[model samples]
Target: MQGRNAGIFRIWKGVTVSQLIDAFERRFYYLRLSITDVCNFRCTYCLPDGYRPQGTRNTGFLTLDEIRRVTRAFAELGTEKVRLTGGEPSLRRDFTEIIAAVRANPAIRTVAVTTNGYRLARGVAAWRDAGLTALNVSVDSLDARQFQAITGQDKFHQVMAGIDAAFEAGFDKVKVNTVLLRDVSDIHLDTFLAWIKPRPLQLRFIELMETGEGNALFRERHVSGELIRQRLEQRGWRCQPRGRTDGPALVFHHEDYRGEIGLIMPYAKDFCASCNRLRVSSMGKLHLCLFGDGGIPLRDLLESDGALEALKTRIAGGLNHKKQTHFLHQGNTGITRNLSYIGG
Candidate 1:
């Protein structure tokens, strides 16, 4: 074990691997990997007018091999969960292949995907067969008219059927993401609660975070997730402790309800203290923080399998520079113009 090297500090399956720990002593167990930036639905808070190329030169997304390399490297470093995200991850032609590749890693226990649910009804069974373990579909509203107004799509009923299809496909639970947008989200809170009464859906109300393109709307409609949390508490919903590998949601449970509620409030005090995940853009750049300055390029090391050791070393070394928290409270959205660009 003398040649174990500098970055690596542990051995797994007779191979030297490093733990992805930051200077703040936070260890990462989950990775958010984006495979594409193209999304079909234009969510009002995310990509309002639909996704456009960031600039003139469009450098495509990560290939299957690149995805495999990155996931392998992270798994070696103790990443147990890999969440494939995008403007909509299902948009990729090789999405099932991508899922199988990530799930192929022995160290990775969960292979999750966050999509718009446009393709989930028909394609979810195949995706589940291909090794997708967890699914998060964006359902901004339950009302069809409001859903169209929020997501710029008329596929409300279709997406709902997709959720039903997911359960038929053998998934025990499906997490639904809904961004809390003042009057927009608040108006349908009762409907959301009623819909989850019998199903095992974890309806997560995400606090609207300000991005470069969402500044105007953030001011006009951003609502604190605390408001919902207080109401749930008063209704006899007890707060639940988050698991180590869980996302940044403060989950709550009620004895009478079959489903649970989760609140993701980024602006909450000390919100980043329990951070246990890392993000990589579809273009192969590692984002230490979603709202950080810029990314560290890892694409060069991912070009070939021969650079696997170098890839692991680069990822481990980069963690030393990871900051303690994001600056959303300070009104600095970093280089992210919108959620789709960085796979939010």
Candidate 2:
């Protein structure tokens, strides 16, 4: 079995593949799957009001079988945690089927989903029953009008209900992912704290990145995680490093509260060194870095005779291309992918 420092090898269906290793020697155990490139709500910083999906059925996106096979391959190659992402992964017509298919691989230990929670309240039970290990709901602001303005949707109540449903459905780990806006963050934080205080969910603040056409507004609206943490500290909330962290978040809990808070500062902090991930776009393109664009297409070979062997070799080659960091340059000038297309 092929292995790397601090990494594990895998055997799926008697096919033993090497551990996932990138050029920087980082061992990868997490795979992020973009099941679809469409969402019901258009968040201002992610996908503006008029943004349309760029996924193409024939080339850009993957079919159910394609996703299943690739996930199996990745699982065999040592992917322990799998997260379903999207424009909104729930937008896929057979969303649960896809999740069930991915979760079917016994080697994949954790199955998580990131969604906007628009349709979650109604469908939360089904997903929870399908072996969903964790749920991350994107709730940017608590202000009704501000929430409506940011998401281009007036279903804030529905989203909140979904969050409640996730907790009620016995999801042990329900995380609230929020993208802080410089102008409205403090006010938003107050509402967020008040709402999250009594809940058992974890609230994670993600530093906003300028992707696609949203770059023009990045400098003005982007609020650093450091500032947010300082604001919380000043308010008598103690922040400390948690002994164990989940994903890329730097998590901490308040001594007085049951719930905790986390920070993912992609721009403000250089976190690429410890990043253990590989991304598969909804259309089947494999991305080594969020900002870089070189991808290995797997559709054609997935049906071949020696497909699994070829896939392992190709994955190793792809790891050699992983960039150390993502540069969030301003506007359409640097990172051209919008949130919807990138499935962030």
* lDDT computed for candidate 1: 0.89
Candidate 1 residue spans exceeding 4 A from truth: 1-18
Tens digit of per-residue lDDT, candidate 2, span 1-344? 12433233656887544478776667788888888777778788877765574534445457788878888888877787889998888878788888888899998888999999988999889987887888999988887788899889998898999988898898866898888788875556777777767878789898887776776678778877888878878877765653211478877677666787888887655677877888887777788777665577766766744687677667766776677777663232233477666557
Q: Which structure among the candidates has the greatest TM-score?
A: 1
Tens-digit lDDT string for candidate 1 (164-206): 9999999999999999989888777788899999999999999
Model 2 residue 186 lDDT score: 50
Task: Give the whole-model CA lDDT for all candidates, comma-separated.
Answer: 0.89, 0.77
Error of 2 at 121 (Å): 0.9
Lowest summed lDDT over 10 consecutive residues: which window, candidate 2?
A: 1-10
Clash number by candidate, in order: 0, 2
Best by lDDT: 1
